[model samples]
Target: MPTIVHEFDWPDRIVVGTVGQPGARTFYLQVRGGRRVVSAALEKEQSAILAEKIDEILDELMAGEGNPFSIQATTPVELVDNEPLEMPVDEQFRTGAIGLGWDPATAQVVIEAYPLVVVDEADIELSEDGDGVEAIVVEPEEMLLVRMPVGTARAFAKRTREIVGAGRPLCPRCGDPMDPEGHDCVFPEA
Candidate 1:
């Protein structure tokens, strides 16, 4: 079957938002254009990495000779979006892999997210000779494709970082996340 693509070109809003409380939060990459909205569940680490990489890309462009693309060093003030995620976020799928790219033609950042692939024992088949087991290659049924302008991309990265940092505070002693109740920090013995 052909893969379903939720393509958004220059979406009106795109953001990384959490559903639950800090420690038990679930990260979501949501995109909206017009009345259509798509949300993909993703790990906190994935969200952070995505934002970091995007900023890196933008910074590199900004450092280019003569700053040809006019990449902003920081997110544009007018493009800042502090609003919460759209209500009733219906997650389309759990994101397994994410791809990021730069589109020079449109001066936009392209992001693609693929759903997680799960293999079941039932998917395995016996070989023609019935001697070996053959595994069926599973492919994602749906994916999300979003493209944003440079300024929007920068704003997105900034917002993502803030959302991620809003989570559990770190235990200064061990550099581990501290629980709301308390934290039992472990240290290496000399």
Candidate 2:
């Protein structure tokens, strides 16, 4: 089957937002271009790492000797989006893998999210000669792709970090997330 690609080049709005309470929040990477919107469910760690990597890429570009592309070191004020995820919040797919890259030509950050792949015994195929097992390869049925300029990228990272940090507080002693009801801390022996 051919893969369905929800591509948004130079998206007008792209962000990582959550639904539900902090402890049980569901993180979503949503992008909008015109009236078209795509939302992909992702883990909190994935969102945090994506933001960290994007900042690293932008910072590196900014620190270049001449700074040719003029990457912004901070999120542009005008591009800051604090609004909640778009209405309906229809989830197209749950992200299995995320790919990030920089397009030097356009000075844009490219993000690609692939749907989780589930392999069943039926998916496995036998070798031509049926002598040995064939290698297994899994492909997603759909993916979300977005490209954002430097300023927008910076803003995206900033908002994503904030959203990730807003989750449950960490236990001061054990460094584990604290549940609203309570927390059991296990201290290490000296």
Kindly give the number of clashing pairs for every candidate.
0, 0
Q: What is the TM-score of each candidate against the true structure?
A: 0.90, 0.92
Which stretches in model 1 have alpha-carbon errors above 4 Å?
121-137, 188-190
> Candidate 2, after superposition: displacement of residue 65 in Å?
2.2
lDDT of 2 by residue, 82-166 (tens): 9999998999999989999999989999999999887798987555447665766666788998999999999999999999999
Give the Å shift of residue 62 in candidate 1: 1.4
Among all candidates shown, the one with the greatest TM-score: 2
For candidate 1, lDDT tens digit of each residue in 23-102? Answer: 99999999999999999999999999999999999998899899888899988999999999998999999999999999
RMSD of each: 4.1, 3.1
Compute the lDDT for candidate 2: 0.92
- The RMSD (Cα, Å) of candidate 1 is 4.1
